[model samples]
Target: MFCHSMTNSMGEIMKKDKLVFKSVLLTSASFAGYNIGSGFATGVEALQFFAAWGGKFAFSGIFLALLTSMAVLIAIYVIGFEQRFVKSSDVYHYFCGKYFGIVLDYYIYVSMIFVTFTMMSGAGATISQHSGLPAFAGASIMGILCFVTAHLGLERLRKALSYLCICTVLFVLFCGGYAFLTSGVSPIAGSANSEHYVSMGLMLRANTFGIQNPYLSGLSSAGLLIVSGFAWASATGSLCNSKREAVFSGIFSSLFFYMTTAVVVYLVLTSMDHVAGTEVPMLAVVHFLLPKLSVIYSIIIILAIYSTISGRLFLIAKRYDRGNKAMGFVIILSITILAIVGASLISFSKISNVVFSIMGAVGIIVCIIVLTRFIIAETMPKQLL
Candidate 1:
């Protein structure tokens, strides 16, 4: 009872303390920044994921995703609290078991290479469209930034990402508010719904676009959140002052994220038909709303992409280094070469779609393990094993 009381007190303290608010905001922003990468900022990601599903599915899918996510996120946060996993490898080891954990650690190293590819692709797309530069120029610039930021160490990286994420959100809010004010069409216009609840085919084919397994949208999306949020939770949860603070941060940050996403979705839905066809959906909408300032919007897209690239590269360097300066430099150099190659090969959307789908399955498995462990720990009276 006393423990429960303390938990309640921690929750209240989180509300009253300005420092706690900053910590929670920072932690949440870090996680959000990591998860909201190139595809997300461009808005093509939402066009494919949420807007594809129409009004009702988008509505229900997002709600279910958040509901299921809170439980899984809290479970993951609790494990991180107990284990204090300071390394990316330690995070995989804890959730994936001993043998599989080793495999996953290697898998993540390989997988991050592909994500690095997508970032390069995004940077190329942005500069090519906005400044008429060669695609390689943008990719090279992003690679250099990521290379530099990786060496800044995690503490500085977190501070940097928090500021970038705050800017991204503020910019998004401004764009969303502007779009909403000027939007003549309603959000559900051309949606798969007359009204979301009254829409037919609630299960399969629920999406406005013809993306497959519309029924799995909620689960797959929830899985994506877990997979993307996993690295941050395991790698950074210890930043919170206590388990209570960690949980508080996780819950509220998620709320902040989905709330922001809801705005983006509304904006996308209002301009659904047009944004759906573009390579950079957010830029497309901004161009439509405020064409005179498209140059500034492009810069924001590049910054958003750069933020994720830097954070991912930092984690990869730390993975190899365990904080050794020489080894971290070597890993960063090798990854930079591979990312340059990735830019020459494919477009951003193609790479992001493939990477997100592959990682979604892995995220689901991690969430299941955490949920099972939470259940078992609850059933046992004496201890958490």
Candidate 2:
């Protein structure tokens, strides 16, 4: 009874001291920045895992969004609450052991480093894919730009880049809404097949390779969404530095994301009569809906890729030695080299699945560890694990 009363009192205090609206908005924007990347804006990812290869598995995306929002909300709330006790540096330590925490921290550092390189490569690829620049050349220039901008630190980078991603997403949503209003909606031709595939449990783990078993697929999907949320929440917490701020930001940003993606799904699904594959569905939709706006979208794609690269670079800088001159040189040099190699070996169309697969597994374990700690802290005594 005492514990229950204490729990209730804590909840009331938390609710009363909830994240302010302004802080929440900032947090959500940061989270949005993390969530909207190459695979997100292009719809290639949606097509591969959720739409085409998944065989009209439309509901999977919805499920993904739902699960992602829930996990993120929890993560953000925990991070926000923990701000009094733990800074961003100790978030991992609180989740896992000191050894495990260090491992996870370094893993996060490595992941951010790689993610920075990949984003730079992706920027160049987007330019090559859209403009006439060679992918290699594009990668080099992008890597340079990212390294320069990342030096400015998180405050400046987030202020500048968040708008870029947010604007592009808003544009896409506005266009999608317009398209839907004008053309009207229609069901997928093989909706039954997609539904059946989902029902049969293939859609959850529908890979480029083949259908995974029901159990594995379900778990994989669950894992991906959860990690996405955790990663997003960590980024959010870093931005807001409070639990209430993270929660509110997560809630608003997630709503915006869902609405935006829902519009994309509608636009892409409706335009299938005119466009088939998922690879360039956005381009197709743009070409079909407003031919004159092609250049605008091309720019948007390039900027979206840029925002991601810059954000990742800043993340890497923060994780590594923020003040060390040698670390900056290393980050720049390493990322540039990796970008060149990445450009040579991988195309967004080719390597997204593999990257997500490896990252997804690691992300899930991290998220679970963090979430378990949060739950225990909230519910149990410190004496218990």
Candidate 3:
């Protein structure tokens, strides 16, 4: 009887641990979802940053960009824990000082709204591609959903995105991986062949210096990474009970994001020809792999849209008059309307060129501030650390 009691007690402890483990994964998955939204999920990010370079060179450029971005994410997440920050502005103030911090605080609204807009546009593009729906119809549907979801409050926000993130990550990995391995199309196959076979370092430099605005793509890639991950990851970090948990969650989140990107990149390269010029590239790849599941594929992308909008709205809400639900609703509605207008005005690829590239510039500014703080902290006395 005592042995039976002992076994039951052990089972309870294991069950508790399993709950914690699942909790961590769900939170991390939410962070990963932020990165895998319309931009990464739809293939616009890959097309502009990596696919434009043609074949494997695009992958190389993305590697260089992601390498720097990864460092920025890790630093920001760890510092977020150390500072015990509750908002993105707090971290900005720590690294950027007072005036700049306030400047960034305002910019956060603009930058995030812009990102939110792009997500709306991406959802539109994906749905239109999936069926014959108009882009306006698709964006409006997404905008309505996001606006409503914003009203459900934070705990529900967390739960909704957590489940959505799980679905997104699974589809991207399994579907994307399978598509890449079996797809017959490859953009690299038909490249000029002049620079097709270049070395990784040279390939990156060739693309970096090879383009009209050489710094645009690389800088934007890093910049978007900053916008997407830091605030969400930091919030996730601050929720943990201990420093170790915070750091582990942040790293795990980043790992999953990179893994999704790698799979999308591979799938894009394999079907680079079909997707390169298209608005919703990943959807194109999906259609090729599972033609009948187009609607299902689109639904998954829409689910991802919810996660992105929710995370962005969460950050935006904290900046307003202390969780003012009304103000948050106004802000979300206003942005969603604007996003619908902008999304309807152009092709997904054109928006990528204009909007995201600019965001990339913002990212560079953010990276400088974070790195400066990191440098000073490391050089300072032990007390600061």
Best prediction by lDDT: 1
lDDT of 2 by residue, 270-355 (tens): 66544453235566678788888877886776677666666666656556656787887687667767866786566655565565
Candidate 3 colliding pairs, count:
2
For 281-311, candidate 3 gives per-residue lDDT tens digits of 7788787777787678788888888678767
- Candidate 1 per-residue lDDT over residues 50-147, each given as its tens digit: 76667656666667667777777777776677678756677777666789888878876666677778878888877886777877888898888778
In model 3, where do residues sit more than 4 Å from their true spots?
Answer: 1-23, 86-88, 184-219, 382-385
- C-alpha lDDT score of every prediction, in listed order: 0.71, 0.60, 0.69
Against the hidden true structure, what lDDT does model 1 obtain?
0.71
Worst 10 residues of 1 by lDDT: 201-210
Q: Give the TM-scores of the predictions, in the order they appear.
A: 0.86, 0.79, 0.83
Candidate 2 steric clashes: 3
Error of 3 at 180 (Å): 4.7
Q: Can you list the residue pairs that collide in candidate 3?
A: 220-360, 223-363
**TM-score, structure 1 vs. true:** 0.86
